[model samples]
Target chain A: MEPRSSGLVVLVLVCPLAAAVLLQLFGRLDRRLCMPTALAACLASLSLTGVLAGNVARGMPWVYHPGNWGGLGIELKMDLLALLFCLLIAGLASLVLVYSYRFIPHELAPRETSYYTVFLFLVSGLLGLSIAGDLLTFWIFMEVMALSAYVLIAIIDVPHAFESSLRYLFMGALSSLAILLGVVLLYGAAGTLNMAGVLGVVRAGANGQATLALALCSVGFCVKGAQVPVHFWLPGAHSAAVTPISAMHSGLVAKLGFYGFARFIFFVFGTTAAVGVLKMTSVLQWIGALSILYGGIMAILEDDLKLMLAYSTISHIGFMLLGISLLSPAGLTGALFHLLDDGLAKACLFLCAGIFIYRDGTRSIQQLKGIALRTPLTAAAFTLAAFSLVGIPPTSGFVAKWYLVLGTLQARRPFFAAVMIIGAMLAAVYAFRVVFYMFFAPERSGALQMDDVPPAMLAPAAILGAGTWVLGIAAIWILPHIQRFVASLVS
Target chain B: MSQALSYFNLTVAFTVFIAGVYMVATEHNLLRKLMGINLCGAGVLLLAILTGFVRRGQQLADGTVAGTNTVVPAMQWLAVAGIVAITAITAVGLALARSHKRVFGTMDLDEKRNGVKQAPPQSTPNATEDRR
Candidate 1:
């Protein structure tokens, strides 16, 4: 937790904000330069994250009091887990920016400089969400992120996009409202918004309203994470948006919900047997298991490529939830690992979908049959991502799934082990359905003439595909560390 | 005696919440459904205000430690602000819903199952045609 290391945290969070401001101030100077400028900012952040990751690997978390902000102003803290997620986000965001250079032309006009500005703003908010030390600050960053996302989704201006965006807005507002209520109640009981302070109170067995507040906050976070019944809006919103955005949304935005949940369980609720493990005392496991089954089945049935990917996201998220609900160290680590794996795999899938749309001007799986022959590299990337999705050996997805299964065994939750296996099988069905349909299905006459995706797009997809395996092989590299972090936080 | 007053607010809040949930669950009119969701917010705000009573203070003649303090008063004010903000937002939401319905000819999510089907009114096509 060196002071210098903490400085890197502030830089990571603020780089995007500063870039966003620059974009706003001078984005109009030369409209064509927006993409390159945004990419440069993202790349700079990625490099900063690489340095911070090394720092985190060496020691404890580094908390940078921005302007001595932890004492008075806005505090930025970067622990190992936060660093991992931030790096994942920044890295994938860099790729998305790379893709946007080519993809934006197909969907948006040249004067969409403001769009990139808001996009940068959204990234800044996500960085802030990952690292904020206080609940109030966390809530503020969450709102900024959610607001920017709403605008991004609605910007499609296509008919379904508007309605879906409206639905997403309503849902986002509800979650924010619920979170505010929970935070206020927590503040009322604990008399502080600081995570450490709240953790102290909850650990010391604060009763009555504070307990209720914890329950409400958990509910709010679950909604954000797209738990069942509350997840209806995600499919429409994800499917209807532009492709790179779909990738970013699936990869990063949903992880914020898991981050919030992690912060709450570890920081606010503590690892008390009552609150952490037995909090499920009634039906939490059932809820997680049911979502796993439901999201998987529905994903298999989906006809639209993007929509199926969205449902698969729901199913994959269910695995994370099941891992967390196990309330074991292995389980939490598994959940966290899956967050990384799912982000990369889902990003690859969405980018390929974008490539499909780019090539054929259609997103229907049936219409896309045998179209991958026209773009074998894209098809290969799809197969690798699908293998990752199905948790095949030698991919990051397998590492995540392995940990989750081991967690289920350690927790003595055999049913969840079976559920994870079933979820994986279902993932295989939907993921390969798209791939096989794209590559092997009977050829159709007069399909739109298509070309291989440009290097900018192919490069990101290939990197993510490779990362799926690299992370798998090196899963143990981070496992012990992530386990220690989660256990230490829970302890 | 004052407990009864707080209880009344609590009851009213719960009643509003139930009614709001009912509206949201049952209503079909798109605007009405949005209103129902909004009414649910009112209930939540009311409940938040009432929860302050779980630690209410009595007003004494000297107004010593007995009086409701600044914290509760501030939260009450914040709740009021929340109510106002949500109401204003509901109005904006209603306006957006109305316009969307006008543009699409329906607000039923089920009806728009296949997307906006009217083909975008040819989209001022000629200007873009020249470039292609």
Candidate 2:
């Protein structure tokens, strides 16, 4: 299908790009201008993505080819899958930027301008990744996102943060090299970098080179996604970064790996013959199951609240991977739905954790005794996010997991379904443990009396907390559209 | 002869890539690991350029096959971009190492050797005063 020519795609990318460059140039003029500039860029991109989503849903996917070089020029295609993730990236980014308004001033005051600049660059990278139409474009944006993320993770300047960021950088660079190798191999085998062009070649007949490329790319994405065995870098990196950065990492950055997998699995190597030969889906399913179990168990044992959430992120990523690996319509829909739902809930949880740190200056769950009594709204938001994470009913997590279970049944994978349920149970154990500390634990004598966090910080968490419920209640209307999306994807 | 040369290039690329991976996986020094990362990237870039080499022979502007194979200039452009990316990563990694050394007083990654303990959580000013 020829994509409709639309500038909306370019506008979506240019908003953040322009803002990042502008901020780097003028940001030092006044630190106060940085946050608003970043926030405005984020909101502008969000609105543009919203418009692009509307066009895609109503008509065909939008494509923008810069320089009109045809196959040689880079392609930026915004399909249903791309738009879905774009919405999530832009929406969560706006909230995180708002949260950063207060958090940055308090934590890393002097470096605020640079923080906003890098943060906008990060947003641009992610948004670019979403709309990237070819493997080379995807890899370039992947590097952009990874580089900015390393900087953000280390921005705190603490010893632990630096160490963790270094470790993450090493692992990230290794993964990126592997991915580049895969892209080169794929280009050699397929003679093209455009995803559709490669798909045509792959469908005709895949070769050993294509298989090797697939394996390399999958391994690279797995490392980035934090699937178990390669997941060690996550807990440290996620916990050590400043709170808003942690939220972005947990909420959006890690999901990019899964996004890469979905694009390749469903869009390029999607043929039944290719899938059977690769046996990739089943292997991925088992890995997802292991990650689910491992992350959940480790989260339960973690004492640091941020680390616990980080572990839970690994578990949740497993759930989405399992859904995608099912390769069924319901399964894909569930995975995409979980992607949005988890991003919102997890970002909210991290933002709420930021509030605790801002107020109490402690990350240990034990140190959070009776915090709910002091900051009831943030606590309530925390509980709401936890419920969503635990897949409690009336929250979006349940709806996403429901489709996933249905998908497992559809795929006749009863064992994986059981794994999903067990993962949820483990999630509940850790999530409620934190909640139990906050709401029910005995108060420490002479605890400082503090009001709820300033509205700038609290509102972002509250909005995302409410977003979880809104998504859940709206899933009734949303699921049909997702099913349509899945149908389009599979067919 | 050119075919043999391309095969040799492929062999060297894989060898350097594996050697780099080994260095990154086994090296204890932070700088060595960064070097290993660069080596691995260079190997991949070499392989990337190798891909654009016309295996049969060069196609001249007149579309006749030539005696010598020509490298597509596009791959060179890609290699240049890869170099820039690697340079940026190296700069960041070096800065990180410099700071890590300043903070922990060592270049070693070993936690015990560096004696780097996790920083205690920052205590709130009001809470600490209340406790006092």
Candidate 3:
């Protein structure tokens, strides 16, 4: 089917870019306009994405070419996958920006303008990446995202923040180089930078160059996604950023790496014939499994609340990767669903952590004893989000985990299914430990007298916390569309 | 011999890339690591430039000169943009390292050797207290 040509796709990126530029220009004069402008841009993008999603669901994917450069122009294709990612990025960004209204004033009072500007830039880059139809465009947007993230991570100017941000920058630069090399190699092999053209070349036959490109790209993305061996930068970087930034990094930025990987594996590399020759799937599967166990164990051992949540992000990433590596329709469905579920749950938890820090200035789990009594709403939200992460029944996490297990069984990899179960149990141990500290443990002597945070901050966390359950209950209506998309991808 | 000479730039690119990777992996000093990252970026940009040449040669062999000029300029533009990005990252890295030195009084990343006083994790209570 010929994709319906539309110009509205560009507006999704334009909204954020315009807002960022506006903020950079006049935001200093009146800081009060900053939050409203940023929030408006995000909501505009989210609603635009919702409209496009509706169109895409009606069997008409929108494709836009920005310039008149014929084959050389960049293509922005809004298919089901792209729309799903756009929805997640814009939707979560709207919430995080709302949370930032109250959060940023406390954290970076003088630098609110720069913060919002950079934050909007980051959102634009992520949205651009989701819809990027060619390799070079994807790389460019990836850099935009990475650079903004590096700035946001170090924006606080604390020594540890700078150190961790520097580490992340170096690693990110290396990964970008690796990815660029892969793109160059791919261009050499396929003679085109367009993803559709590359798919055609790969389906004809896999060459050594193509396989090497795949390896380089996969390695780059793995580093970005915080797979086991190269995951050292993640904990420091995620924990060092301000709360909303931390939420964005853990909840959205890291998942873009997985999105890039999925696009390449399913779209560019085609299917088992090419990937099987390299035995890439099983290698990735093993790596994902190792990451799951390592991240889970480390999370359980961490005493710092944010650090524990950061580690759990790694474990959840492993689950998504494992789902993708299974290379089944069911697995892809589970992975995509988990991406949404985990993004909401993790962001909600981070926001809750922010509230705790705002109240008592402590992220130490042991120091947070009986925090529930003071900030009852945040505690309740944290528990619900934690339950989702642990894959308890009637939560969104359970639905995604169920599909992943079913996927493993269908692929005849019962051992991986067992691994998934173990990973969930590990998740339970860490998630529930935080809940236990917040509720059951006795209050410390110096505990601060504080109530729930302002409604601005509390609302985002509460909405996301409730979103996880709502998504779970609504999965019956959602999963079919996801399955159909997954089927289209594999076939 | 002629083929090897013709592909000399590719060889140099790979060599530079490997050297950069080595320095980045082993160097403890922040400045050296930044240099290494720049080198790695330069190598990749060089490789990208070489791709244009390789493509042009293939096109010439196929008796297609219409797109030859276009390919070279496009690659050159890509290289230029890459250089700008590398410079931006270098600037950010340098600024970060400078502040890091001001805060901790050393540019060495090795905690034990430099006896660098590590700041408590930013999210911790003590750090927030310090800020307050």
* Top model number, DockQ: 3
Q: Pull out the clashing pairs in model 3.
A: none
Give lDDT: candidate 1, residue B23: 71
Q: Compared with the true structure, what per-residue lDDT tens digits does model 2 show for residues A1-491?
A: 45798878988988988999998889888889998888899899989888777667754789998777553436899998888899999899999998898889999886888899899989999999889888777878888889999999988868899889999999999999888888777776776777887888777775766887788888898999999989989999999999999999999999977898899887766646346667988889998999999999999999999999999999999999999988888888889999999999999999999999999899999998888778888998999999999999899999999889888988999999999999999999999999998888876544545456789998999999999999999999878777887887777
**What value of lDDT does candidate 1 attain over all alpha carbons?**
0.76
Q: Provide the lDDT at A335 for model 3.
A: 95
DockQ versus reference, model 1: 0.14
Candidate 3 docking category? acceptable
Docking class of 2: acceptable
The residue pairs that clash in candidate 1, if any, are: none
lDDT of 3 at A102: 89
Q: Candidate 3, after superposition: displacement of residue A352 in Å? A: 0.1
TM-score of 3: 0.93
Better of 1 and 3 by TM-score: 3
